[model samples]
Structure formats: C-alpha cells, structure tokens
Target: MLPADDREIDLKTLKFVQYYIELGLQAFDDWSNFNVVDQFQTASLRYQLYEIVYSLATYQAVYAPSLRGKVCEAMRNSIEKSLTPKVMGYWKWESLLGKWSLDWDPIKKDNIMVSGYMLKALALYTGNTGDMRYTEPDSLPFQVTKNAVYKHDIHSINKYVLRNWDDSNFCIFPCEPNWNYTACNVIAAAGSVGYDRVFNQRNFERRRERFLKHLKEDMCDESGTLLPIKSTFTGFTIPGILGPVGESVSAVDTAFIDVPTSARVWSVIKHENIELDPKSGNYKLKGLSGADFIDMGSYMPSTGAAFLSFAFLANEYGDYEISENLIKQADEVESPIEELPTGSLRNKGISVWVGGFGLRARLIRFRDWTNTVVNGPPKQCINGPVLDGYDFQNVLVAKAYSPNGEDLELVLYNGRSAGSFSLRLAQLAPNASYKVSNGASFVADQNGTGIISVKLDGRTEVFTEKVQKV
Candidate 1:
C-alpha cells in the first residue's frame, strides 16, 4: 500500500463518506426494483434512475474494489433487467400491468439529456470493466450482431447526437412537447465524448467542438453562465423545465443541471461567476428554477449541489483549497446521514438526490487517496485509523497499513494557513507505545484510540509517515 505512508486528513470527511454511501445504497434498496413511478404517480422515473445509476457507477469507480464490489455487482445486474426491447428502441414511458415502464413513444421520449446520461453510465461501466459487449454492432439498443456492418447499427448510440444536431451546432430536441433545454444540449454534447471513448470511434469531435463554440459565443450571459433553457424550433432562450428537478421549476433558477454539467464539461464551459460566499465561505450561485417545496428546498439543495460539483472539479484540477472549502460547505447542507425520502421527487420526495450529491462530495474530498481516475488502481486502505483528530479546518488525507498490520501509515494535507492542530486516531492497539514518523508523540488508550499533536507552519504542508508500534 504505497510503502506505508503517513498523511493528515479531517476525520469527519471519512464519516461523511460512509454516511452518504449508506444513504445512497439504502435509497436504491428501498426503491425495490424502481417501481416508484406507479407507486408515486410520477413520470420522471427515467431521469431518477439515471441519476441513481450514475452515482452508483461513480461509487464503483472511486471506492475500494473489495468494499464496493457487491454493490457494483448488484447495480450491473439491475441495469440489465431494467433495459427492455421498447426502452432499447425508443426512450419512452409505458404503463404495464399497473406498473409504469420506460417504454414511451418517440415523441414522448425524454430529451437528449436522458439519452446522454444513460450513455455516460454505460460508457463508464464499459471503461471500468473493459467490457466490449456494449460496443458490439447489433446489441439490441444498437444492433451489434454483425461484425463490420455499420449500417442500421442501432448500437451506434453516438448517432443519437449526430442525427439530432441542429443548425446551431447543438442538440435541441423537445423533452416535453415544445420545450427544449440548454442543460440537456450541453450534457448530450459531453456524452458525445463518452460515446467515442466507448466505441473507439471518431465521429463526434467536430460536432462537440462546434457546440462548445456556440455555448461560449452565443449561449452564455454577461457573467458567462449558460442560459438554462431554449426553444427547439426558434433556437431562442426560453424559460422551460430546468432539468431533472422537474417542470415545476424554471431551468434558470436551479443549479441541479448546471453545476453537475460544469463538473462534467469544465474544459469546455468553465464558469467564472460561481463565487465563494464571503460570510459562509460557501461557493454560491444565484439561480432557482423551481418553487420551494418540502424535502427539497429551492436554494439549499441546489447550492449544495453546486459546491459538491465544484469540489469534484477542484479535486480533478488539483485545487485542494477550493475542494476542501467546497466540501466543508457542502457538508453543512447535504450531510451524510440525513433523513431522506424514498419515493419520487414530484410526488413522494427527493432526499435521495441530495444524498447522491453528498456521495459525490465524499468522492471528491478523498479522491487524493482513492481511485479518482476511472481506470486507476483498486481501493486500498491501511489497517488502523487513517485519521481521528479535529482542529483547524481545511485539509485532505490518506492512509495505509503496514503489511504485518502492526502499525499504520498516515498522510495529512494541510490546505489552510499555518496552524497548530490536534489529531485523534481510532481502532489501534490499546495502550501500546507508538512511534511517529514526523517525530511527534502520542499514546493509545484502553479503547485503542490515540491522540497526536501537529504544528503546521505553512499553507501547503503534506505530513506523511509510518506510525509503528514500539
């Protein structure tokens, strides 16, 4: 495990990660076959399922394989069952035997947003597992039975974007009757990249570049934020369904789609207007698409979504200070183990989505130590507590165990200014003499807990070492 290193991190971060993972898994389990559409009188099950699947795939991509294996297995199994002939052919919703099925007509299909999300999830799964079954020419959703014939290949999901490209160089299909969404267009554009990556084809780069140009030059406002919705026929900005939050909210009012999309396509549409709040230190974006409702706040969850999203992006770009502050603020609203609703957002509730964002936050905060890359190494952990202390906020952490399991390796990243701090370690050998790699002093208690004192003299100090038993 990386030669038993010592690192510093906020212990609360680990707790939050565990909390969000539990919350997400519980929500998925409670869905019990995702039959909530009939149970809750909601028609947005397709989008909801996509969110759940993406989050699940993220879990699989980031966490330790041993810890996340069973969960990922279950998710993959459910995905195969969820796909039907009708769903494979057309993205529509149908009613079957008192249950709602995602077998709608062509006109009723969810916009390219849903299509993009589904494609992304599948692509990520394929990338992670190196599974080529999805890339075959006649695979139902896309006929991959033939080896070399590209004609009539429905599995060429990339065609979904190419065929629907408008003169504006972006997709603008009607998600509902006449309303098209800008967020959907952008997501579909990003999905084109995933499509190419999965199939090893090169049909989307030019289209993607043109769409990105349209966004930078025409779609953004004075502050450089993309307008949330537009008309399909007229190619004009219009107030419409914001995103997966549903039609009850305006696209311009919520951060749901904008923040997540920013994380996915930051290279193309980096938003400079999303600023950090001076008072709370939370990165706040002003926009609310839907009316305030129970379980889902108009601004709270959306704000949290934006923070978590930025945290993910910051981690990717190696901006740990931004990532840490964003993660802390996100924890305030989207805690790991809050009481979440089990049913759909339009009818029963949407606490699960909040938890989904929380899960993403945890993934971002700990990515320095976890499998941040989709095709990176598997999950690895040290034998003892990686972190067990609190004081002077804003830091990242990682840990590993000695092969003999007699000692712990720790790594602490102080992302803030210089300061003195207290650290606690849990689950170690009780009342044992210990040696710190940094020449610090500490002792374990009867309960196997230990405390260490640290003095950081700079804004960016990474403390790493092997804490051996004496």
Candidate 2:
C-alpha cells in the first residue's frame, strides 16, 4: 500500500482501488459465465466487463498482481469473435444461452467507439513483453487498434459522427448511426486488449485531440450552442454534441428545451477554447448548418449527464475546464436518496438516489466508474429497469453519486410501498436533517462521511456513509 503519508490520496484511495479489484473479480466471473446473448439473440449483459478487465490490468501493473492467464484468454476470445469490423463497427446484441448467438443490427450504423478509458494499459500488459507477462490476461479485448476501428492508416469511421448526423464532411467523419461514448468502448477495449503497441500512447492522445477538434469545428456553433445528435442542417456528414434529456428525445427539441443545458454546457466546456463569446452566448448561434439557438431553454437529465460527465472527466483526466464552483457543487451533490424503505436489514456501504423514475432514471454510480447508463440504472442498485411490466414491486435498489464524483450511496425502497422503511445512512448529513427530494426523515451517523439511520415508507434499515467532498 502507498504510505499513509502519501501526498496524492488517502485510505479512501486504497479502499477505492481494492473495491475496484473486487468489482473486477465479480464482473469477470459474471461475464465469463453469464450468457452474452439471450434466446432472441439480444444482449442480456453489457460489456463493462471489458472495462473491469482493463482496470484490473491497470491496478495490477501499479498496485497489485496480474490476473490469471486462463481467465484473460476467455475474455479475449469472446470479444474478438463477437466483433464484426466494418466502416466502423456493427452492433450485435448477444444472447444468454451460454453460446455465441448474435442479434445483429447493421442499420442505424455509425462509427461510435466507446470504452472505459483503461483499455490501452490492458493491451500492453498482455501483449509482447520480453517474456509473456501476466500483466495482460487474455481477457483483454483487442488484438490491434487496426482490429478495433482503424484499418491501416485510414479511419473507417469518424469518431465525431458516431452520435451526430453529418453529410458534408463525409470523408473524415461518419454519420450518427453508431459513434458516441458507447463506441469509445471499442477504442478503449482495443487498447486494453492490445496495449500501447497497437493503441500507442501518442496515437491514443491523437485520437482524443482529433475527436475534440472535430466536435469543435464541425459540430459546435461558434456561438457556444451544441446540437442534439448532429448539426440538424448538415445531416450525417459531420458529428458533434447535440442537446438532450434522452436519446429517445429528438435532438431538435432537446436543444430547445427548458431544463438541462448541461449537455450543451459540457459540450461548450470540453471545447472551451472555442473562439466564441461565453458571456454573449451568441456568435454563429444559427449558421450551424444554418439554424438558430432559438430553442434555448433547459434540460434536466441532460444537465445531469453533462455535469456527471464533466465530473467523470475531472476524476479521470484532471483537466479543469469548467468553473471551480461548478466542480465544487458537483463535489457536494447528494443522492436523491432513501434509506432502505422496506427491508429491516442494515446494509453497510449502500445508499441510493434517483433523478427520474422508470426508464428515464440514471444510477450515476457503479463499481466501474465509467460504466455509465444512457437510460436506466444497473440492477445492482435499481430493480426492474428490466421491462417486466409488473406494477406492484414497491422497493428496489436506489443508487446515487456525490457531486464530488467520489462517493456512491445506495438505498432500498418500494416504488409501491407507503409505510416507512428503515436504513442506515451511508452517504448523507450525519446528525443533521438532510434535504431529500421525497423529504424523508433519516437518522445520521458517521460511516465515511456520515452514516444514517433511515426510515422510508414504514420499513427500516441502516447505511454506512454519506455524500463526500472531493
């Protein structure tokens, strides 16, 4: 372990690191055995397992031991076999029959490359060393970036166009059929699977720079406004950030909405060096493929997504592009939390929060921090984003992330129950009446920040910590 006097972090760092290691182990076993596809060839399980493997490789390289070879190999085989190289990539939802059945969707195909930012390290670990090092387990995802999205010197897909619709700049950028954070996974996985040999550090940095430049030059307005999916006027030739609450919500309306300017704000902030007027909030406001920021309002979840996204970047990259206040506010954010609402069990290290209900809610926190959700919370915390359609399951998992992007607090409650439930505060104001959306009462104690004794809908339980300041 790093010394207690280590200047960079605290025991929390150790805990966080160990937690990730454990999480990786859990995911490894889960993915190795869990069916990749379902009866209808649907992807019952997500691909964050690749992320876990990548992180594990990283942790082992600097802090712990590398994973076993057999496990790594299995992971590698599954991912490589599953991928179908194209202009960019094709999305084939897998099934859960303990087999390689695939549900392929070639349509709506764009070149989005999403992955947890850890892939490069993993690939290097497993790849050519003087001798075969256990650093990379076969579980690493890509054999080569060429195998990832790049083919030789040509980029089959434009990273910018993955989520945007652009047509004019067709040569370098692709349309929104596939590019986005999801696609980042492809790049990250390839890098992790292959390491610096293929996705060289210099090359990876180049990709990030290129992606940013494209978003600024092709997708964003000089006036600082971002489109929803793509510049509406340009179609799929160019790609950039568009406004949004949900992908299902039309980009046109999202840009014009009233609550979540966060998506737009983040786009502006990420490329903050844009030659525009931050104060005027006007420049080439409309010439963006010839439209107007006429639809400037607010987006709730988009704001949340953007803020959380910024925080994620902050946590990962330490690039302070946004406001200090904004970062600090994010650092102090609380879970729209509930103590366990039905069960009497006092679960430690869990707290929950919600931004929206049903399909629109996002669980912001997960063991793999970059394991984000575009629509619903992972079942690890929330129950039934599962589409079962049965109404009466009142209590499920409630998870939330602190603004600091450091603490993950979760809770349990019945969406259907009314009587008060019990729980301990894991992430909240201790010995203090904290503010929650539901205005529920909580008993606070100190676990990490402040553990709470909770009562919601008549059931009861205990939690171990509260929101933390970064």
Candidate 3:
C-alpha cells in the first residue's frame, strides 16, 4: 500500500516539467532584454533553453498532440533569439553594451560547440513535430522568422564540423579555446545524425561511424566510462577546468554531453557502472577512476536534478527502468511541487535547467508510435508502488507483446519484499480478455479499465497475458 497516488505523481511530474520550462522561457526572456557579455554564458544558456524546449516538444508530440506545433514554434523562436548574429560563418558575440567589438577575437566567436547544440535543438524539433517552417520557403512563419539571428544552415554547419574532424579520429573541435570538451563532439556528431534524420540525407554516415568508433576506443577512461574532456594536443582524457573548477569525469557533465556512440554503450553502462537500488530505484554512481575528483560539495544542492539528465539519457538509450529509478530519486530529494530543482555546477540555482531535465524524463515515458519498436509494448500506468513503495516495495511491471503481437506479456518483479496488493490498469480496450499467471482470468469493463488483487510471497515474480483483438 504505497501512500503515493498515481494521479498525484503524474500531476506533480507534469507540473514539474511545465513549471521549469516556463521558468526557463521567462528567464531567457528577461536575459534577452539585457545585453549579455560572456559568449560562453550566452551560448550555454541558449543550449539549456533549446534542450528543454525540445524535450517539451517531444512530450507533446505523443501525449499532447494538439500542442506539438505550438511547442515547435516556441522552440524555433527560442533558437532565433538565442543565436547571436553570424559573421563569416560563425556566431558574432556582443558585449554588455550590445556592441560587437573588433577587440573580440573573431576566431573565438566561432562557437561551433554552441552551434552543435543548437543544431540538436533544431533537429529534435524537426524530428518530433515534422514542422518544416525553417526548411521550406513557402511555410516559413513570417513573424517568427523576421529578423531572426539564427538560420537553419544544417548542411553548412555539418560540413564545418566534419571538416574539423581531427587526426585523433574521435573528437570534433569547434574552436581552439574549447578543445578539451569531448562531449561537445558527441553532441556535434549527434547533430549530424539528426540532420540526416530530418532531410533524408546520408551525407555523414561514414564520418559519424568513424567518429563513433574512435570515440569509443580513444576517448573513454580506463573503465570505459565516458570522460568529460580529452586534451586536443594530447588526445587523452584528463582532469580539466569546467567553468572555474577542475574535475575528471563529472556526473553532471556526463549527463549534459556524453552522447551515446551507439545502443551498445548504454548496455555497457547499465552492466558496468550504474547501481540502481532494486527496492527503491534510487541510484548511485560507481566505477569512475576519480570519484573524489568531482566537487560534490558544489553539487550537493543540485546533484539529484543533475542526475535526472542522465536519467533522461538512460531513457534515450532504451533503459527506461533505469531512467524511472533515477527520476524517483530526483523526486525524493526535492519534491518538484514544493520548490524547483537547481541546475548543475556551471549554472547552479537556475530553475529552468532543472525543469529541462525533469521534462526530458517525463517525455521519455510518453506514448509514441516511433517508440513501439524500441519499447516493446504500450504500457498502462500503475496506480500502485513503483521503485519505492510503502507497503509493497520494489515491485516492477513491464508491458510487452508476444512474437506475433497477438498477446501481451506483463512481466512482474518483486524485489526484497512482498505482500498482497491491488493495482489498476488503464488504456486497454473495453471487454479485452486477460489472464493472470496463477490461472486467473479478468476483463476490462466498458471504461476499458481493470483492477486485480494479488498475493506475492517474499521475493517472487509473476506474469499476465492479454489476448489481442480478434
């Protein structure tokens, strides 16, 4: 008997995503009014905004289809406003006084790293919403497109990034001052992949493949964990300065960057490093060579939310349970309904980045047709305990389909403790037939819902089958 309400949890999670997105949007709106000086800060802030907006759009694409176009429009607007004007195929940074000074090194202003993230934003927008306003001249939204600083030159940026694919064969160097960031290259490569997805082009397949191969072999630490930085000159992972502090492979950084080279990396990470408490779904880190190197003291306030970004990644990599566990951990640390979560080390206390991760996690659970192959079957939300529970702790449930897609499989897990409990299932068609593992039978009523009571001895598992429609 978990004290938590499924509807309550859902509402809180929804609010968490919405509140943080709004927070980020409002913060950026305020910042847009001011003349921002630091190029790094501006790029970083816009990246965060793009990420949250993209996550929101992903969620709306499935669960709230009516809001999809609106959210995509919002993402486009944010990208336009966030990008500084370009000069000679690069972002032109401005000073606190709103003037682009010649004193600013034009080369340094080639913020390909930020551009990579912006590309990711645009690519995700196109991927999720199928909105082609930026691509088609006839469809361009006039008010939103007018005077926009950023334009979708995905091919040009892709070519620029590809041209700089270094001798290391792994890293993508956007510029010299930012050479150490291995994650930026991961993002840049992902941007290329996204571009291919949007335009039906295979221009960078060989390049992306080579980039991934080298990244897996050369950029990982001794333990195969993705290191935060690899020196441009040295071609090896090393302790590096992030903002003002130095660290090795920081969790927050890994969450921010570390684009998975492939699905296999997620398998490796799930097996090698992540330790999810079977009962609570609360997670802890392991296997990094320099765990102490991370500034935990600096991360304390936002550590939980920062980890949510990793949870979001876990979701992206087909580790939905791991992501769910991480989300549970985040909720326990700071209830989203009470106060907003904080940001990672670089931008601590910023509520929007916090929301961005939350939204990312929530969107991962949304029902999408595209997800059918990766995620076995459509799942009904359980009203009972998941991960952490009061009465029946550690119980797990997954919905799957038989090989022919003629029957549904409900895989169940009872971790560490067991008791009899009742659970509700939603979204089944009315009068659908169902069978329990223990020779029991049930059917959904007119409302397409059902409740089942079961007794589980300690540390037991079970299954149920749903018959497909005739």
TM-score of each: 0.53, 0.35, 0.56
Off by over 4 Å in 3: 1-10, 20-29, 32-43, 84-110, 136-152, 166-171, 175-180, 240-301, 317-321, 334-336, 339-351, 365-470
Per-residue C-alpha lDDT of model 2 across residues 224-295, encoded as one tens digit per residue: 444334422344423433332222122211221211432445354445422235774321111222111111
**Candidate 1 lDDT, 36-152, residue by residue in tens:** 432112223444454455555554444322122333444454344334332232232222221254334221243454455456556655644444665656552321122211222
Task: State each model's CA lDDT, in order.
Answer: 0.43, 0.28, 0.45
- RMSD values, in order shown: 12.3, 16.8, 12.2
As for TM-score, the candidate ahead, 1 or 2, is: 1
lDDT of 1 at 244: 24
Worst ten in a row by lDDT for model 2 = 351-360
Q: Worst lDDT window (10 residues) for model 1?
A: 247-256
Steric clash pairs (candidate 3): none
Candidate order by TM-score, decreasing, is 3, 1, 2
- What lDDT is reached at residue 104 by model 1? 40
Which order, best to worst by lDDT? Answer: 3, 1, 2
Off by over 4 Å in 1: 1-43, 62-68, 81-110, 136-154, 166-174, 240-319, 329-336, 339-350, 365-470
